[model samples]
Target chain A: MTQPAIELDGVGKRYWKIQERSLLRSLVRFGPPNKTELWALRDANLLVEPGETIGIVGRNGAGKSTLLRLLAGVSRPTTGTVTTRGRIAPLLSVGVGFHQEMTGRENIYVNGMLLGFGKSRIDTLFDEIVEFADLADFIDTPVKFYSSGMYMRLGFSVAMHVEPDVLLVDEVLAVGDIGFRIRSLDRMREMHRSGTAVVFVSHWLQAVQLLCPRAVCMHRGQIVFDGPTEGALARHHELLTSDADSAEYARGTVRVENRQLLKLDGSPAGTVQQDSAMIYRVELHFDESVESPQVLFQVYAEDGTFVYQMQTPLGESWRTLSAGAIATLDVTFLPRFGGGGTFRNVVVVTSIDTSVTYVRDDGLAYFVEPRIGAAGLSDLEAKIAIDGVDRTESRPMRFGGTWAAVEGA
Target chain B: MNNRSLLISLAQKEFRVRYKRAWLGVIWSIALPIFQSAVMVFIFSRVGRFGSGSSFNYAAFVLAGMVPWLYLSASVASSTTSIVDASDITVKIAFPRAILPLVSPVANLFTLAISVLILFIALPIVGASVGPRFLFVLPAAVLLCAFTATLGLALGALYVYFRDVKFMVQAVLLVWIYITPIVYPPSALKGAAPWLDFNPLTGIVGLFQRAVGAPVPSVRALLVSVATTLVLGVVAIRAHHRHDRLFVDLL
Candidate 1:
């Protein structure tokens, strides 16, 4: 077996949260600066072979960016070692080190050199970079004149042309237009095929799922789960929901608990098929008396786009509840998401007139499999006919077992 | 690809971007020093009178001093804040952080070269005899840049933690020229001339003055300048090596 392309051996990073950064205060203070230690990452050990892509999923401050910084060699781990076999290109952000006053051509050469490419090498790949960026006309124009998308495209184009052995991507794919995104994705896929090791970090679970087969889920500076992408995402959601639960309990008014997505038979639903009916259920415990509580349901795609929202009828009085009352709320709906992505179900409890919000439950998330050969935001369930002959699958693709199993399919 | 080439390209970019939009372009680089030198020569020649009985031409001596002084002040000021100014790049990319501090000195070499050329051209008009001693300006320029770059590296690293270094540097530069024996000769200080040998820039500015037929700086002053550069160089290099990857954390 060849060597792993990237390796992290028992890595940990400790950051000192300095209370006061003033030089005079630091000088006058006793032993050390007033600081608390924060371990951004702890005991992380990972190895990726050549041609492998791994996604990282985590909530904010969960050590995801810290890990990427280590991988990029931008920061040193306080403990252990991080090793990469060959050239590493960090696409942490597009347009890093790009001078606004410099022409596009000049900026490309400078950015390429900063990434460790020689001027002669940049010259050889200059045409290809500009063409890929689709900025042939603006190559001579100063970057300050280019649109933000154009700047990002040029930066991405230069980075892709480097063809690094190990690529570290952190949410840079979210930039640029759809056409450019697609092209950049294709470029990444090409890099993946050519035996490059990739570590991708993003909040967009759908993009992570599409790009990486394997993933690591981070929580509170620890790797809670490292497995297939589906399992990692599931673990990530579990951590998020649990964190939200503790925060909600601290609010002290109405507490939302036991949020779940359930099947018709009351079993917990892991993955729902397109157009399949599932119920979102939650328990609301009120600390004070409430009048005519209403429920609002919202669905969000994995990328945080609001997919659907519905609420209780306006100006309608259900029933008033006395203090210390516990109420269970359930709403049933079909998962009609196209392109088969993970989605979240959120329920908000409020007054009948919507004047006041009592409690908002941390969302429960589930997966939806698309109709066969269907891709988009909504599953239109369209039929195609050729010469009066209908050509559409009579039954939608069946997604069985838990969401993790769907990764193999 | 290598740090050297990266430094050269970055410096080139820095040099070009400075005057990219300005209508006068690089002439500003040549013009600023000449104008400053002209004003200094006019005022000091009348009021200061430090150079009245001097053997060498006073205009040439002042211009010679201004060449390195302008480069030193400009390079040091910019390079001291270089790392902080490039926080966007430093926080993301991985490179030797020391390079950021060194870039300004290298970039200002263009202006330095122009000032030196103008000094040489004006020497003849100012009645100073140009001789083979003029070649001393080459080593003088090199040593001047080395000293400026090392100081910049050290200050740039410190600036990441204490922002007061920025204002301190500016304040120091304002008062630095008066003490460096630039407008006046060291002999003009009378018995206090020996004390002037302690300033690090005394030796550097002395070389420029020497190029235009001023007396050679004291051995003690040259030793002090070289020693300061060596000590600062060691401190700067070690600081960067230890804090290179860690600088991004603070940034």
Candidate 2:
């Protein structure tokens, strides 16, 4: 396993929230820093073997950046130890630290050196880098004249070419055009296949699913779940939907045990034909008597793009439940729009007053397959009619071979 | 690559960027100091009693002193803020933090070398002789760069923690030149404050002035400069070694 390419043991990082910044105050700051301590990360532990790819998913400020920084050796852990075996390259940001006035050619050398490559090494890799970034003619031009995508491309190329043993990528892949984005991911996969330990951090769950066999979910500076990618993601969603008292109400008041997105025919359906009716069912049991619970459903496309959401009104008021009662609620809808890709259904059962959520069963992966020739978010079939004549495809016939018609067409 | 190459690349970027955008190219880096020295020589020559003496070619004296002093002031000012200024880069990626402040001094060395070439070419024209003493500028230049880097390193590291250091360095550099006997000579401070010899820049400026045969630098001043350089150099290198990985936290 190559002795854990990266390992963290009881790692913690403490930062001071200084109230004031002055030379005089700092010189005499012997009395406890005149500030409060913020532990961005605490007692965190991780071990990544060579050739392993792991995904880290977390909300903003969940210490993800802090964790990457420590692993990159950019920041030292305040309490414990962080150790790595080989050259560590941080794709923490896209082309970070690029000097604006320097040429693309020059910035590459500078950035490469910072990533632990020598001038000769960079020189050898120079042609490949320039070609990879697709900036052959413009490599000598100062980067200030380059577009943001060019900058990102050049940066990604240099970092990838370094062949580091440990790669820490943090949310920087979300930019540039889709073609380059896919290429970058492919290059990362190539590196991973060659024995580099990859720590991938992104909010895109689909990306996690595509890249990682195992994923770690972080919350409030600690690893909340670490196991199969699906389980970690499910736990992350559970964290997102419920508060601290979730378990209390989830088990005692009303508990949603299972949920499913099924075709109206009652067969399991992950990918169904567009415009077909499907049923989202949430099966729950009441441990204690409760009245008028609100149920919510949300649908999101494969890319984590929000699709549609619905909630029972403030009054499902007439509805009531007693202890030991079990019920199944079905939401049937024809997904007329929001098609073209895999989707998922999330069901949340909350208290009537909206104070607490009892359960959120979110791992129902559903797919609204792209209808054969359909494209975009939905299949909005449009047939243009002019003067009561269907002329959407009449351009060639109406214009025929007329010279003036060619320009108009 | 090794740290040495990284340092070289960083310095190369700094050197190239400074002169690349100007219409005059690197010529401006050489010309601006000569212009300043020309004016200082003209004024100092007329007011000989305030300078070293009528016997000395004050023009050569000012050029030698001005080159290092100008480099020091600019380098130190930039170093004071280098760490804080690069917080964005520092926070995102990890590298040796000490190198950030050192980059400015190393970059300035390119311009300083060009200015020194101009200084030698201008010396004979200003009635100063080119003799065996000219070789001394080699050691003196090294000393000047080393001193600036160390002072800057210490200041840059401190600046990250104490935001006031940047302004304080500027305020000090403003009054520092006049007190260091750059335009005049060390003899000018004989009666007013002999302890002025203890100021580190006193010996540094004294060395450059001596390179042009302006005045003999006092032993105390040289000792003080070396002493201060050692102390500050230690502080700078040690701070970076201990805090290089931790600086990102504060940033």
Candidate 3:
């Protein structure tokens, strides 16, 4: 019967979009200023137990930041209630309240206090923060001179040392060098293991999948889906593709329809195994007559990294399509993604010279199971030997495995 | 208690950062008021002759008035925009937004203290002896700070909603010094001296002048100053309590 670390009960935040704020105009006019209410978040109800790590996935303007702000207690919800227990540390972007002229050592004390840490507590944790940030050399230098990466590292380092009961992170994981990024992830994992509740918001779905067992997907200021990370990401992609469809429709040209990722036997591919061949099938409806149309196939990792791309060779004539013609296209390829994760397959139909893109379809999103013990974008099938003993796990670790198992294997 | 420490640390940061790059550092805190006081003494003693008929040392009187005036002007100007200037932190972290506007006044305390010290030292050199009445300076300083802080807090909240408050504050400060009996004694206004009592600063500044042996201001003026501070303090506290979390929305 322990209290949830964080709770949101029918919470909503509304912002008034005021057209203009002028003293004279307000005094002269009898009524209030012209304004529209924008609900950044609405009817959100959530409960997170201690030690739970939950991810939030959504497109831009989807209320992720609004939810984080609420959880951090930075803004009050216009309706309902948001309750968080114990100390809440928000690792927002870069340094908050960091004065440019202040040295790193000074900023640490100031920033730490702003996070509700006392002076004596900061004194005890100062060295650890500096060491973690790897800014021992620049600790005395003003922050204005530090690089953006250095600034972010310092900010992140301080928040981690706070040992907060509830941690709300917003897009801060994407900064810093690769080494720091890995160290941060490790620090977050350590915090997770220590029973801190974490609410992580990120567009980096791969990181989300690696860290969070559960996730909430948001769209248009509402929670569209809340469940496992896999299902949330699937829902997110559906919204993204649907949004793309409307944008394409506005262009008024060839329309890509009925896109599907199917196994060799033509059944819908739920989860394709590593190196397994699959076919991306789609139909193209042309509004006007066109010469030999070119096809471009692209694959993107869940984090939006462009994995691979192929296009029709120049000067190759497949066939001409007349007005109102319907053509079926099938692209076959082996999913060679390493450390398998969810991926998106996009198909673009363009003119022969590749100058005019008639339609771009991003409908087919599928998961690839990585080879045993394999991780990363491409499965190079890397093997390991330690002191003349084979150390690689025979059963390769697949995508969506537990974080600890992935690290241990 | 935690928030108290936060306020102190933020004020410390503001104090340190302001002088970090300045070549003169904190000396400017003492020097700026002395320089301004000297200029006023020169102009009024010769050009206007307003202090010729006064019984007290005009230099000390001007310096006394300058101490509170400078603190009020600087603190109010900065505190009025404190919340908006700190949008970076306000939009992310949660804390008492009142601390933001209060920091400027608290941070300027160093300067206020330095200016007051300079005034005490100049009093004897200008033939104005330090009397036990100078004890009034203590309560005077406290009231001055309270008034500035409360005003700053209320205006800081207002500025978040209407940016015009910044310019309005600046415009008011420009005309405020003249009407506050800072440069000229209330007696200089003759029959209009009673009207000057309506200005809240008349009572606070009169305390400083009284410390230097000038005639005490009307009792009504002191009440006016106290009442204004109390009212502004209540308005400020209420505004912050209601809008502390909501300020981030506008930010």
TM-score of 1: 0.93
Give candidate 2 regions above 4 Å deviation.
A27-33, A243-306, A309-409, B46-49, B52-54
Chain A TM-score values, per prediction: 0.87, 0.67, 0.87
The estimated TM-scores of all candidates read: 0.93, 0.80, 0.93
Instruction: Specify the CAPRI tier of model 3.
Output: high
Write candidate 1's Cα lDDT for B119-180 as tens digits: 88998898889999999899899889999999999999999888888999999999999999
Candidate 1 lDDT over residue span A1-409, tens digit each: 9899999999999999988787787778887557999999999999999888899999899999999889888899999999988888888777888999999999998888888888899999999999999999999999999999999999889889998999888889877898998798888878888988888998866667667778899998999998877788778877766676665454656777778878889997765767668888888888888888888888888777888889888679878888899988888888887677767788787887888877666467666754555666788878889998998755322221233255466
Error of 1 at B111 (Å): 1.7
Lowest lDDT 10-residue stretch of candidate 2 chain A = A394-403
- lDDT per residue for candidate 2 within A1-409, as digits (tens), equals 2499988999998878888978788677676777888888989988888988888987678888889988888888889899998898888777778999999999898888888788889999999988888899899899999998998999888889999999888777878887888678778878987889989898755556556778898988888888876667766655654432244435546776656667888995544556779887777788877788888888777577787888989655767788888989898977754225456677777888877877776546643434433345655776668999876532221111232246477
Off by over 4 Å in 3: A30-32, A250-253, A269-274, A300-307, A339-344, A352-357, A360-377, A386-409
